[model samples]
Target: MNYILYAVPFFFALIALELLLDRWRGVSTYRFSDTINSLSAGVLSTTVGLLTKAVGLLTYTLAWQQLALVELSAGSLWVWLLAFVLYDFCYYWNHRLGHERNVLWAAHSVHHQSEDYNLSTALRQTSTGFIFGWIFYLPMAVLGVPPVVFLTVAALNLLYQFWVHTRHIPKLGWFEWLFITPSNHRVHHAQNAVYMDRNYGGVFIVWDRLFGTFQEELDAEPVIFGVTTPLASWNPLWANAQFYVALWRDALRAESWWDKLRIWFMRTGWRPADVAAKYPQSKPDLRQFVKFDVPLSLAQKLYAGVQFSLYVLGGTLLLGMGDKLSPAQMLLGVGWMAVGLYALGVWLENRAHAKRLEVARVLLNLPLTWLAVQLSLLSAGPLLWALLLGYSLVSLAALLWTPRTAVGVPA
Candidate 1:
């Protein structure tokens, strides 16, 4: 069962509730550009996962078949409970090393890019995480926990973490002591020195306490969210690639063969001394921090919102039908999604050719859809074709009519 997909509507509903609470309390935790960028990264991650999920599943299944320490049945409630606890134990190390190591951090940093701490920020996830994340769960497989049980527990653990991403929730008196609550998880997301790299537990706060990584939220020192190295752009593609590109450039610049090779695996944000001296990057002053923003016209904002809604709908449909899709069809869908997201990012950034790229995207949809039909992935019926044509025409009209100078600072 795709548990995450079934929870999609509730996620949005909770986000809406958070917004309502923010309004009633006169607090601002969301910005249009930041929230959209966060959600776009999530959509991209989900789309990419459709292609890469087998890597984790197959690896776990193989390990279980070959290395079973004991046979654990899926139907047993005790097995489910034990697996749930055991998965979080593995997740702690996975998440901790993700912060401590450079390569793993590169894959995990996408989730921390947002300056705003809100429900949408929880959705901000990394597309590249599957590359190494499967390694952390092999112990579960080795113990003979059924794949179905492990995946279910992992999904439930993830869903539990979502509600803790909001600023609206304060310290949960007794609950905060045992489980991850909004207060401490906020501390985990913080860039402030004292709070940085503190909490690493997934479901239970007990792991952090036992492992000596726990830090209670300080009332005197407010938490400032985001990574020390600012992402600085709205592009989801760039968000995933920027850290790796920085490391790659540093690797090339390093004079020694050892430094070139070791730099990729060194601590997060660690650059070779020579590279650091020759091409320095300044650390941002937390006291003077400002969130990244770009001006957008009202029409542009409305258009971006409308188009994003369509992408979400398309993503949900893709998720529902993902297993039935061929690799080529999945690739085709991801290609369209990537292009659409990049164009939206351009619009949000108010780039000079934003409108042109958007118009081009609208036009390209026809060829993309025709290609899908040619591949036998999509229906070639007249009604489907008519709908596609109508969609393209309306989108093109909207792009053309959207005002150029309705620009103002985002709220």
Candidate 2:
């Protein structure tokens, strides 16, 4: 599970590296809202990520686990390799449709909405993709790709996608023709008209090149980053809903019912005459929007950094711990972690520094949730009694702080 530790820190290290390299190479990586928005999205996405994993598990077990029609004629290595290729192929279609379809865009646009393209942008994934996502890999299951092999390959393919999200690397010359290079994937993240809806390949750029969706970053018309419909708010939850809601409003505003549905499937920027006349397509110019310094509070930045680090570390640990722990115990532990992290976040937002109290809450949850996990053998009475006492203390503290504005976001 420390995979998150390796992957998440590596992401930040590369992000810092990219900034340094950007200074040397003179590619501007500055965008004012990038850090805050990226971090906010990261928090929201992490909260929802667990829910999607459950959805994936349910889908595989219930629906298309039957689709795994092909048997492994040889050993496990062959099956794993084939699963890798098949999963990538399925991923290719999933990615391609994410760009092609509107409903999918609602889930996926969170990743592309960032104005800055960096390693942090790689972590800006959607929590809602599991809805239609299960469809992409059904072919593999039907072809008889074993569940374990399929899951492993899927994770590996995802791991491969992480590095390409950075802007530090130039096109790998001919390598661009085969693999999905940073250059090509940048097109996937770009907001430029030519770059929009292009380069959907996950591990292979050849898919785009073969499919005629490939575009290169040009010196003359430098690519401007972010969506055509920019996320104008710092609230990450709103970022997930912005486009979908906009589409909904436009659909409602349409003069005809057919025009309502047409707003989605039509070209991305297409809108009803009434809607189009009121809010035109936004053209983002990086030169006008770049901000060099993030200007975060020493306290807030440090707190956010700590929270993000913990999630990445804790997520990786839990991922590996999955096989060893009972599902009940894992769920119990995760619930405590989630609540503690969010409570820590709310406290941090309010500029409250109660680290010792926070630590106590976390430690309390670990043993309690652990007991909850082993409930078959262990009695729940002690755990319940302890939880009641902890809740009472926390509730009293909440009562004392009720006069202060903890919910209103502070500057």
The number of the candidate with the highest TM-score is 1
Model 2: per-residue lDDT, tens digit, 1-411? 324435656676777887788789987764434654565566556545554566776666554445555465335687777777677778888888887777778878988888777776877777577778888877776777766666667767777888887777777888888888788888888777677888887887777777788888776766677887677444456667777887898888788888897778776557888777776666656567642233334454445455445555555555555555565655664665555555544444443444444546555654664565456423566676676567546544543443433333443
- Report residue 136 deviation for candidate 2 (angstroms): 1.5
Cα-based RMSD of the predictions, in order? 2.0, 6.3
lDDT of each: 0.92, 0.66
**Model 2 weakest 10-residue run by lDDT:** 402-411
TM-score of each: 0.97, 0.72
Shift in Å, residue 95, candidate 2: 1.2
Over the full model, what C-alpha lDDT does candidate 1 score relative to the true structure? 0.92
- Number of clashes recorded per candidate: 1, 14
